[model samples]
Target: MRTKIILTATVLIGGAAFAIAQTSHTGHSDGMDHSAHQQEQAMTGAALSEPGQGAFAALSELVRVLEADPNTDWAQVDLAGLRAHLVDMDRLVMDAVVIETDLPDGISAIATGDADTIATLRRMVPAHAAQLARDDRWTVDATETNDGIELRVTSEIPAVVARIKGLGFFGLMASQDHHREHHFMMAQGKDAHGH
Candidate 1:
């Protein structure tokens, strides 16, 4: 069972990685050169950016190269940085919880909890979706509920669901409740201060 789960998770991660590859900005004829832009970013190392932007950018570039040539030299890739980024992602996942509902064609997951917890989900889900959107694997919609806010994530791919589930502390609460009542819990690695 564990092996099966790991295999499934691997497939999902690969699918999501492919989505990232497709969305990465390459040099296009529209006068927008992603390569040049990426270079600029590397040179500047801009601050005050989103939490995982740099890691996401690195993964995006790596995906782009791998897609272009599957046989590319592994030595050229930043394995350490990639590992660090994934660790960061795991940490973030460990700190949050998601309530999942199985829809007819897809899945709907809502982050439920206290005001601050909901707010954290509000911030993280879209940002995560935005990163995934670059790969075209997920679409995110938000609605204001009596509790706080609910994120409606829709994806046609089963791998997307699998990927979301693979995130730690995610998919803990599964319900058919489209009625929108918030029930929050503090996931592992989160303190009483909500940090």
Candidate 2:
């Protein structure tokens, strides 16, 4: 009876260990599959941001049209020019420099610089104004300063400009968040082995 009880206990323990091992193995396999899918998406440019999606979709359609008919009208298939303009717009947004200042009512953000910067800011103002109009929490005023253009941004809440920095035409519409994550991960001083 003592030997039979010992064998039964051993079998139970071994079964539990096998179950735990199988669970961990299945989890690891699912993780690998998910990682591969994400890698595939990144490889295929499926991770484009909003602006990138617009540009990519336009270009893709243009390619399809051209492929269907090599003699397609050059005017109709001029998406490359449109793509170039989109790139320029993106560059203007990414290169914009915003300076924030404290105000009695709210925060003030000044986007000013050289002539070229002023022109870019001016071009972006209508789009920003449209966005601000949609959001009733903020108000904006624009004026030409001696150096460049000053945009006085006010909101009911504090740090409004900083909060809304990623929304308007002046904001970066591309998928640069991964770069920021990589930089943060590197700054954390943790290696691949989690050291």
lDDT of 1 by residue, 18-59 (tens): 988876744355578656767888899964334256546545
How close to the true structure is residue 3 of candidate 1, measured as C-alpha lDDT? Answer: 100
| Tens digits of per-residue lDDT for model 2, 45-110 | 896433337546545654564567765554544444445444545545666666756565444556
- The runs of at least 3 residues in candidate 1 whose Cα sits more than 4 Å from the true structure, single-residue gaps closed, are 1-97, 157-195
Show how many residue pairs clash in every candidate, following the order shown. Answer: 2, 0
TM-score of 2: 0.41
TM-scores for candidates 1 onward, in order: 0.33, 0.41
The true-versus-predicted C-alpha distance at residue 75 of model 2, in Å, is 5.7
lDDT (Cα, 0-100) at 47 in candidate 1: 47
Candidate of highest lDDT: 2
Model 2, poorest ten-residue lDDT window? 186-195
